[model samples]
Target: MNENLFAPFITPSIMGITTLPIIIMFPCLILSTPKRWIPNRIQTLQMWLIRLITKQMMTMHNKLGRTWTLMLMSLILFIASTNLLGLLPYSFTPTTQLSMNIGMAIPLWMGTVLMGFRNKPKASLAHFLPQGTPTPLIPMLIIIETISLFIQPLALAVRLTANITAGHLLIHLIGSATLALSSISMTVSSITFMILFLLTILEFAVAMIQAYVFTLLVSLYLHDNS
Candidate 1:
């Protein structure tokens, strides 16, 4: 059925109000909390991974950009967790929702833009007008660049939503087909099931990569502005 196929993407509700906030916070509960003084194995590994990722992400930025390491790392972890958790049966993927993605994208993207303007107004404005442009094309180029600048956040939101949605839909379709074919041809059904298993593994990787890509793009934007 339609309900079963679409279930993974549908936001749950109780008494007509959405439960998206609960779903979004579920990942935080799953993360191991750090202890004071004596750290457990999980906490130690978590700290090490955090430091490694932060160091690599901040390598391109100056000291000012490094200040955002915490925010960027948090963003990536939250996204990656939500994505992977959604793979659980009967769970919804918040990143597949365009509204949620846009809400996250706009504020973060705007913060970077505003930071650029506040810290280096001349350099920020200079992005709209490339150097060595012919005088006649300057106005046209400025207009094009200006549009592209404003579209970055929208692009980020759409990109995340589309990729997540596509993967979920494909999995749902293949899973349904695998079930339906079981009654017809056992061999074909088995092959389809194997494909489904591989696709699931691929999706797991995609979820993590998309989160990293989103965070990396934000860091690149920060670097440009900084």
Candidate 2:
């Protein structure tokens, strides 16, 4: 496999096509679902777990529907797992590459905007352009709203790209430093190694958090627009 850090970003077509795995992974759940009225023990357990979590959240508040939440959960798990996988030595961080992450973010942003507009055609415009603006400011408001609408995908792309890239770079730098220093001074380099080891845990947390943030923001976008 190509180990070049920047190569994937340069040729987007290669990384751009990676979204297929995510789609294929999630959509395949439908096939595993039982068609008959009766479900096996494992399937029943999964359904119960989903329902239990759904009910608990619904009891607190009803902002997000169960079905959407389930989809969001799947997205979170997929992203988190992919990110963690990339953290392993020599593995490519798909999320670290702008092309891959942006490819994913763009579709997500497009889906959210398309669904929101379809669900609320009138309010879609109004959501972008608020209702209380005076006639004189309508054009200005429209321009602002248009800019804001356009920035959604851009924001998603930059956010994921920056987070993952920074993280991977930090890990690489620390590991390299530890490697270089370990030969001359074991004590100092060991400390650095320990810190880098701790950083892996932090990276794990960040990976999970980024995944949740992405899904949560997507959900909020859908909820607000819907």
Candidate 3:
């Protein structure tokens, strides 16, 4: 009912707490785990996607990265599922919220950084300062790198939030225009509807790609740390 572009993003609270918990867990309820060797269609598709994502990470020869395959897989699935489901009429997209995105980003990013430090303290510390740095500029470089390191999680959060929010807004605007036009001119509305249809399809692809990109970057961060 709210005409605000962000109205859908506002999490409803029935008992003081926000609605994301339910929305976040919704996918797991419907999609069963792919545990059986001879799997059903859903399981088969799940396994295929997991394998595809794993193979993509392995392309960088990140054997350590494989250790996080499960976490990474779950992350991708959660994000992808939420994004797609949001496209359905009257559905809310938790990923569109910066707070929600940041919540997901910070923990995962912190875990990867901590893992790297725990596994190899010296090597992890080495990343703070590049080799062959000029002695005079060492302090400046370290400060810059430190800031950049801390910015990783925020960057991840913003990237996902921006893409999802922008795509949804564009789709919403176009859809609204199509509806408004329909009352004025049938011919123009028909053409606009066709455009809206195509845009929706494109938005679907964007939803999936944004999820993949979010997971892929996390993998890369994990790889670097590992």
Top lDDT prediction, candidate number: 1
- Give one digit per residue, the lDDT tens place, for model 2 in 167-212: 8878877887899899999999999999999999999999977886
**After superposition, which runs of candidate 3 have C-alpha atoms over 4 Å from their true positions?**
15-17, 34-37, 59-63
Give candidate 1's error at residue 168 in angstroms: 0.5
Give one clash count per candidate, in the order shown: 0, 0, 0
Model 1 stretches astray by more than 4 angstroms: 1-7
Cα-lDDT of candidate 1: 0.92
Clashing pairs in 1: none
Per-model TM-score, in order, reads 0.95, 0.73, 0.91
lDDT of 2 at 115: 71
lDDT of 3 by residue, 1-226 (tens): 5488777778878779877788889977877775767889888887787798878765774667677888888888889889999999989999988998999999999998998999889998888899999899999989999999999999999999999999889888888889999899999999999988998999899988998999998988888888
Taken over the whole model, the C-alpha lDDT of each candidate is 0.92, 0.71, 0.87
Model 1 lDDT per residue over 38-147, tens place: 88998899889888888888999999998999899999999999999999897888999999999988998999999999999999999999999999999999999999
Q: Which candidate comes out best when scored by TM-score?
A: 1
How far does residue 78 in candidate 2 sit from its true spot (Å)?
1.0
